[model samples]
Target chain A: MHRIVAFFLKQYPFFLFLLLEIVAISLVINHNNYHKGVLRLGVSEVSGTTYEIWSHITGYFSLHQQNRALAEENARLRSQMPDAFKASDRKVFVRDDTVYQQQFEYVSARVVKSSVNRQRNILMIDKGVNQGIAQNMGVMGSDGIVGVVQSVSANYALVLPVINVGANIFARLKSNDQKGIVSWNGASYHYAQMKGIPGHILVEQGDTIITSGQSVFFPEGLCVGFVTDYVQSPGDNFYTIRLRLGVDFNSLNHVYVIRNLMADEQHNLLKENGDAE
Target chain B: MQNSPMLHIGRFAALGFTQILVLNNVQFGGYLNPYIYILFILLLPLRTPPLVMILSGFAMGMFIDLFTGMMGLHTAATLFVAFYRKRIMKVVIGVREEDYLGTPGIRDLGPWRFFYYAGAATLTHHLLVYMLEVFTFINFWSVMLRTLANSMVSVVFIMVAMVLFERRRHG
Candidate 1:
């Protein structure tokens, strides 16, 4: 303690010098706007940067909750899209009766399990019959079509995404009215084949393909992909077109299960026609 | 030798008033204001304690800042000069034991030695004052120019004041 006291007494001048300098600097910063602005900016910048780092650190721990919230928000927004309505014209018109009827509803679900490299890729979502998720409903992501619900349990549902070999979606060219059936051939997750486009349809390399409303699973104009390449062989009846799949399967997270209100009516009509014939 | 505290206090009041009233208004060509108040720090007795010297420097600077509103620039520069005055004295007059005991004036140390000692201190004070006033090195050359021009006039005024007041001691 004695030696420590002596050491401090020897360094008293330096301590005094520092104290006086601090006083002077505070006075300068307090009185001068320019110095005050610079000091405030430096202090806030340091603190703001530290706060951002802390937020990122805490953010990693709550990723599951954040993903759930995001999925719910996406579902709410997807249900409001024009394609979710059955009306062809979007213009608002006042009528005695309701002019627009909601034809589609969406339930938010998370992909709890998935695979891409397999021939029969399947996705399991966290929502099942408890969340109104039923089999054969269309599942779409924010970017494009994902798949149809294959089966459901009490709290989980299985999905067959577009990359699966058994999956097929009726897709049409956006530029022209040419329609084709999109399917996977167990080759690559990035590419899918669109079959039955006739040869003289003037297909281009970059034509955007979207879902045709004729199918009950997916709504009209739901994006499938852009035509990366297309070729027609001699005496062939149709064009062999390859498409870059819109939804990236490797990073699939949240999906919306589209519930078509008219699906039962359409299917019953078709079944009755088949039985009569 | 130590001067009486009353005498130093009187000097402080007189010099501070004159600086705020007369010399501060004596700006020529908007660049040539003389700061003669620094002489308080320069003319302090060599035997004065370093702490007293530094505090007196700060008080005198704060007094001037109150009137001129330059806000801490004068205090910082004056404190700097006061802190380094002992080293400057040793450099001007050799490190003799008796040299530390005398007052610094043209009579105690010859005119040339005193001039050099006071001139260096005044130049340092002026450079610091102007640099702190500008607060940035973007106008470094102009700050240097102003410091040199102002220091020349201030040194001349200080020397003339010294000769006038201490002429009897010189004889």
Candidate 2:
């Protein structure tokens, strides 16, 4: 008994270190965004408050640039307005009443904290559950798709951006309508990889990529990126394509959280179908 | 020589605050993040108990992780460094010189020795962090590059900080 006690006493630091490391690794592996969101609320509040103050000071310096970007986005949106398209048949009165139900709604929020360098990067936005934000909703910047909301607290939410290695978004090429999965390779923030794209599809440089709308998170036609390059392994059926992401993650400030109204219904139906199968 | 517990606590608060408020915001090319917060562990008095060192390491790491939402990457890495710090110190400044070693600073161990000690600890911590962070060898080269790049910046920052801020103790 004395020897055992002495042995443990001599190596208590090692034991304590091991215990703490185990706890950390378990927290990393087992605790998903739900737990992280709740666990991080206090920390986020403090960090977010500090960041808000810092951004206030720095916001003055970037007002012109931000205004220009917002203006460009506004112009792009204006060009897509229904009024911008001339009616081919002036005689035909199209009744556009109750036929279309709004599938997604956007809630505007400011990014309070973000990091691009980490392999599994996460971002914090100022809006949370109180502002109609929830887990698994999609987030989009003014320019393009940003990320998916992983978790939400009362007043803050965490976003798992596309730059994260664990992030995978369904995307399609606008040129040929071929679908692929977009994911980061943990290398460059500017570039992400598109996988599961069959080699036969003729993809070209600068071809636009958009959300496939196959998932419940993001709606179709949301801009993701443009193809920069592609290559196929000798015997593989899939071509690994590189993309230039449209959203500049490093400078992300304002974003919109997308609330999909029918997500739960669709998910339940799919789950039932899978069970039946 | 043992320093006052108050000094250690003060250093902890200072380094932790700087790490979260200042260093966390500083990133170069989305790769080089200099985590000078580990300087707290590296600068502890040599005679401090290993248990205290390890506990302090976990506390500091947890504080940074909480603020950054990195989950537990920093905590795990810092704990590893704290556990192996004595071994690393002995290796850097020969086993025979262990008795003469005080707190690891430029003043205590001289520039070269301090550099080796801090560099080894920083690299180990950074490598563990990036490895656990990426969690896969899918882009092994990229992870290696990130580790090397970040470690270089962190080591330089830690050395410069030691030189600039460490109080010169007279024998």
Candidate 3:
């Protein structure tokens, strides 16, 4: 007992360091499974509020650019409006609304805080549970698919972006519908690698990659990126295709969170089929 | 040079805010993130108790973590800087900490020695941070490159800040 006491007395600093490190590591490990507890609430709320205020102050700096982008998107959307099309004499028929029920809904949210330099990048947006935001919803910028919602607080939601090493976005070639998984290689924010493309298929530069409507997160044909280059190693069946992502994560501001209305129904049907098999 | 806790506390808040708000946002080539917050740990009084140093490091790291949502990464890395700080200081300064007066900075150790001191400390901190963040050795070269590049940027930033700080003190 005396020896132990003396040893501790001599090495208290090391012990203290070890103890604190363990606590920190445990916090990291448990942070993933964390529900909306008091500590998380407090931290998220404070950080969320601070980021909102800061973004508001900084938001003015880029008002002109943002307005231009918004105007361009508005122009593009306006061209798709039903009223924009003139009356046609050749058997024009209105599509029945009941035949095409809305499967996806979008909630517009302003990004409060975002980081792209890290291996695992997360963005915080102003809308949260109060605005009908939930886990696993897909997020998209004006240009392309952004990320998926990982967690949500009452007033904010955290988005796990495509640039993160942990995120995998299923994308396909716009020309031939060749499917592949787009994943970040922890190298650059401007690019990601598309894997699982067969070597036999010829991939060219400037080939557009869009989200494959397979996942419940993103809708079909949302722009993901463009193929910049690809290489097929000898004896390898897969081509390692490099792509330039459409969304510029560094200057990401406003985004739309996509909530699939039929997600639960599709998921339940899939699960039931799997269980039966 | 002031031994007051208030001085340290003020430095803590100032550096912490600078790191979280400004430095974290400043990224070059999407690879370099200059972490000047560790400057707080590096500039602590030489005679500060090891326990105080460790606790302060942990507190500062947690404070940054709360804002960034990276709970353990900063805490673990900054704790290492705190733990090895004295040894690095002793190596660079070639003197027992007890014999030294005032916080170590560009003014006290001159620009070159301060650079070496801050460089070693930030390198150690950034290496641990990037390694732990990647959590793999598969891309060891990229990790090393990031560490070296970011450490250089951070050390340069620290040197410039210390120079400005010394100028202010003198004026």
Choose the strongest candidate by DockQ: 3
Clashing pairs in 2: none
Q: What TM-score does structure 3 among the candidates reach?
A: 0.95
Report the error of model 1 at residue B87, Å. 1.2
The CAPRI classification for model 1 reads as: incorrect
Query: Candidate 2 lDDT, tens digit per residue, A5-63?
Result: 99998988778778899998876664343335566666677777777777787778778
Q: How accurately is candidate 1 docked according to DockQ?
A: 0.05
* Every candidate's lDDT: 0.75, 0.85, 0.87
For each prediction, how big is the interface RMSD? 26.5, 1.7, 1.4
Residue-wise C-alpha lDDT for candidate 1, range A225-263, written one tens digit per residue: 999999888888999899999887766667889999888
Q: Which scores higher on lDDT, 2 or 3?
A: 3
Which number leads on TM-score? Answer: 3
Candidate 2: true interface contacts recovered: 0.70
Which portions of model 3 miss their true places by more than 4 Å?
Answer: A29-42, A275-277, B97-99, B167-171
Winner on TM-score between 1 and 2 is 2
TM-score of 1: 0.44
User: After TM-score superposition, what is the CA distance of residue A5 in candidate 1 from its true location, in Å?
Assistant: 2.2
lDDT of 1 by residue, B1-171 (tens): 247888778778888867755676464643467889988888788888767887888888877764443457688888778878878767766545765666677877778888888888888899888776656677678778778888899999999988987635533
> How does model 3 score on DockQ?
0.69
Rank order by lDDT, top first? 3, 2, 1
Model 3 lDDT tens row, A1-277? 9999999999999999999988876676565343322345557878999878888888999999899989999999999998898768647766888999999999999999999899877798999899999988999999999999888889998888999888888899999999999999988999999999999898899999999999989999999999999999999999999999999999889899999999888789989889421
